[model samples]
Target: MFTLKIITANGNEVIHAAQDPIFHQASNTITFQGYDNLSNSVTLGEGLTSAGGDVAYLMGASGATLATWRYRQPVQCGSSLQPMDC
Candidate 1:
């Protein structure tokens, strides 16, 4: 499973997926359930992707940047379930 961690000024949030999270490449929008420190669920308002699609700007209902999600490259270790040249 792949986990996305978003760092924010308030604290940190996370999203889990069986694969890499999906987002609109053209619109650069993303929708996901974000967990708070208390493990409470909240809907991510709207988000924007970076030009390189390497970063995501998570916004709040008020259109403020709540957190930032950075894309992490999958590990290429031989033992990993996903195949890759190592």
Candidate 2:
């Protein structure tokens, strides 16, 4: 497994697993979850997927970007949906 570090414009950092990090994706939105560096708890985050950009902004609870990460192609997993395969 790999880690995705999201760095915001204001310097806030959120870390997430690179695998299966994207919880939801739509025509214009991509929703995800990660751990806040300060709290170490899972925080809900979102990003835009409409512009076909390699980078996406991860939004915080206040609707501001807490961080950003480069988009990576996801690998297909087997029926077990194990992390080792995804």
Candidate 3:
């Protein structure tokens, strides 16, 4: 099972969860850390995002899938609240 936990800065447990992957690819590697350089600044589980990669030994993917759901990058809003459009 997949597990997620949110901890307080002082080392307290704020939240936790268990989940399962919709898909898995064995013998696959994640070559890229994110969609693009802009992805570097974006945090996981925040805002619109894209992720996939093929590397040496590690292969992992998160977020919704086409079979279960669909997603689109939002338009740029040019505001501090959201740094990028999507």
Candidate 4:
């Protein structure tokens, strides 16, 4: 099963919020979807990354990984929600 939990807090480290792990789908590289939304889908048989922030993970589900969306970040920063555009 997929589980995603986001944790947002203030700058003073007082408003702490618990978070959960997520995944990334890579074809050959273990990185985030910087400009590719298609590489961010939390589906089965996909690649993932968790190198920074220590807030995410990539794990197969039932050996098939087909569940709810656990983690997702916008590929396009100031543009449309496309799969290959940033």
Candidate 5:
């Protein structure tokens, strides 16, 4: 099962659009980090903004942290997905 969860810093949750291709990629990459980020920033920029101060992660079925989800990148692309609109 692919799991991507985003919980806000204020104790709220950010629900992902499951069918969104952006999320599909985020949920798939297990070794994502740094410049190789599995970014959700594009989604966040579009309208997925409840995740601003989020505690987000991509998890494996065994409950390990595969990757951490990033919410936004002001003037750049945070991942291999769509580039952030500048």
Candidate 6:
């Protein structure tokens, strides 16, 4: 199963949203599709830095294009979002 959570706040008020816990097994590395989108991307990394902020480490495989990650500045998780690039 896969679970994802997103929390948001307006002013001092806050709200919580989470998905069911989804599980996966990765012996060496893990790969999945549709993660380029925001909603499905929640299950990709260990933690969220800030919206769009990411740090990816790819192992040696074959093609250079096969081992790449997309990392922006602001990452989104819970209610806190920050600009990791700045």
Q: Could you arrange the candidates by TM-score from highest to lowest? A: 5, 1, 2, 3, 6, 4
Alpha-carbon lDDT of model 5: 0.45
lDDT of 1 by residue, 1-86 (tens): 23444443333454333132355332333444334322222233233433222454545445565556443434457666332335
> What TM-score, to 2 decimals, does candidate 3 have?
0.23
Whose TM-score is greatest here? 5
**What's each prediction's TM-score?**
0.28, 0.27, 0.23, 0.18, 0.41, 0.18
**Over all chains combined, what TM-score does candidate 2 have?**
0.27
For candidate 6, write residues 8-35 as lDDT tens digits. Answer: 1111221112222222222112233333
Q: What tens-digit string does per-residue lDDT give for candidate 4 at 1-86?
A: 23232221211111111123333422211333322233342232222444212222333434443333322343664656533335
Q: Considering only N, C-alpha and C atoms within 3 Å, which residue pairs clash in candidate 4?
A: none
The lDDT per prediction is 0.40, 0.41, 0.24, 0.29, 0.45, 0.29
Q: Positional deviation of 11 in candidate 5, in angstroms?
A: 1.5
C-alpha lDDT (0 to 100) for residue 49 of candidate 4? 43
In the order shown, the candidates' Cα RMSDs to the true structure are 12.4, 11.5, 15.9, 13.8, 10.2, 15.0
Two-way TM-score contest, 1 vs 3, winner: 1
Give the runs in model 5 whose Cα sits over 4 Å from its true position.
Answer: 14-42, 45-52, 76-86
The list of candidate 4 runs beyond 4 A from truth reads 1-66, 82-86
| Residue 54 in model 6: lDDT | 29
Error of 2 at 74 (Å): 23
